[model samples]
Target: MKAVTGLGWGALILTLALAPLLAVDLILIYLLEDTPFRILSTLAMLGCFYLLSTILSLFVDALTGALRSFVHSNIPRLIDTILHGTVSGISLYVVLTLFPSIDLSTLTVMAIVFVHLFGASFWLNRENSKEDVPLELDSIDQQIIHLLRTETIVSCVERIQHDYPNLPKRDILKRVKRISQSNKVTEPFHGR
Candidate 1:
């Protein structure tokens, strides 16, 4: 039942994400003349937009901090939204520049930017709200940290999975990494 609900929600989210892209494609079809390269150019523009936006988003996330941190504060969420919108908008510009035949008006560009901003904010809020991990480390977290001192993260993750089948590997890795970072800050370094 849970899996089914998750699947339904996933489908809805996917549809929402693709909505802007499809809208642009429709607009392009209407605006562009029926040239031999129309279809080919349209497909290329779509591919470039997706590829460039995705790559830019990753870099933006790294620079601004993990989008998941939105769960902790609305500030990160707001920052992420702005950055995402900028990246998407820039990607659109690059694509349009590459394919000069596919010309979009200022109004269209603004509309796409607006959609990107809203979609990014909405998506981040929804995703962050779904998972609420405790800030404080538990015994299991301590064990993971201890193992990290002597074992590889992969090994620690494998051991954790073997011992706690219900625990998520991603969450475990996150906890271990966060705890390790905090420990580094709190502990003093001794220089030889």
Candidate 2:
């Protein structure tokens, strides 16, 4: 939990830091090339892209975690890798924009980088999902489980003794037979 909290904080800091750096880089590129506000728009677009991706991943993970009640899965790890690669790529693009010319060849290189990184992330995600889960128990939880078990066992024993004073444990464990039948019950319907 602490590690996750720390990572979340780190991402926030990176995003915050990247915004101004992107802006500065874009501005410098625009100045050198004598371009217009298109660079600012590009920066904003990149920011929104990362922001949307981050939100979507977090929301998906939250929903999945709520449903499954566990995080040991490839899906979350894939989300993390994509986020990491995106941050790295964004930073690299900002730094590289300072060059005199960002030729088509350079962009091809960036595209290749994206594909390779995403592919590796995909493989890691697959491998992570294939892992066997270890069976481990927490002492505190185990203690609580034992207490619940004892309480339920004691209740059943007392109930049987009250119902059958002399019957053996096997005979005391008779089927629960209702003394009287009751009318059918209905819930207030919420119509579809």
Candidate 3:
């Protein structure tokens, strides 16, 4: 629990720390260029792009989660990040390609920057989600799952945290989510 919390806090602080740098970079890019209006326009456009990315990410996460239900596996954090980045890149590229009178000299660099940003944010989100994992649960430990299945989410999560402090929360949570959704495990719960 502490390990997952610490990682989550670190990632949040790191993101807060990066926000100013992103703003500064945009400002510098604007200053180096001759047109001030382009800077403002670019900034607004980027803001819209980010909002789009946020919406797309939520949609993708839900979609991926649903897809994983059938496969009995969650999307790995790294793969999720890359997929979001790819989706964002394609949208930005399409907009750039279609915009008239705008020179796209910086489009490639901007795509790279956006990908890094999205990947970092997704990494942080993935880490934060580890708070509920029960990574150390073994097949033999299924004995106690009787109690866990009856416990509140918070209680069950805390017990798992306390009992398996060294385990990976992501792995634990992934397994728990799978176990909850699976008829194989839930049948007993339903019968009870």
The top-ranked prediction according to TM-score is: 1
Residue lDDT tens for model 3, 12-76: 98668657745754664555555544665665555555556567777887887788887876567
Residue lDDT tens for model 2, 1-192: 999999999989997866664555454445445334455445654565455544655565566556555543335565556655665465545534543234224544365346535654775577566754423544432332333333443454456556557756643333211101112222224457
Indicate whether candidate 1 or candidate 3 has the larger TM-score. Answer: 1
CA RMSD of each candidate after superposition: 11.9, 17.1, 12.8
Q: Kindly provide the TM-score of model 3 when superposed on the true structure, using C-alpha atoms.
A: 0.48
Clashes of each: 0, 0, 4
lDDT at position 49, candidate 1: 85
Better of 1 and 2 by lDDT: 1
How well does candidate 1 score on lDDT at residue 30? 58
> How many backbone overlaps does candidate 1 show?
0
- Runs of candidate 1 with Cα error greater than 4 angstroms are 1-20, 23-37, 66-75, 131-192
Candidate 3 deviates by what RMSD?
A: 12.8
Kindly report which residue pairs in candidate 2 clash with one another: none
Model 1 C-alpha lDDT per residue in residues 134-180, reported as the tens digit of each score: 46667898787777776766787888888888988777777766766
Cα lDDT of model 1 overall? 0.73
Task: Find the 10 residues in a row with the least total lDDT in model 1.
Answer: 182-191
The lDDT of each candidate is 0.73, 0.49, 0.61
Ranking by TM-score: 1, 3, 2
Cα TM-score of candidate 2: 0.30
What lDDT does candidate 2 reach at residue 165? 71
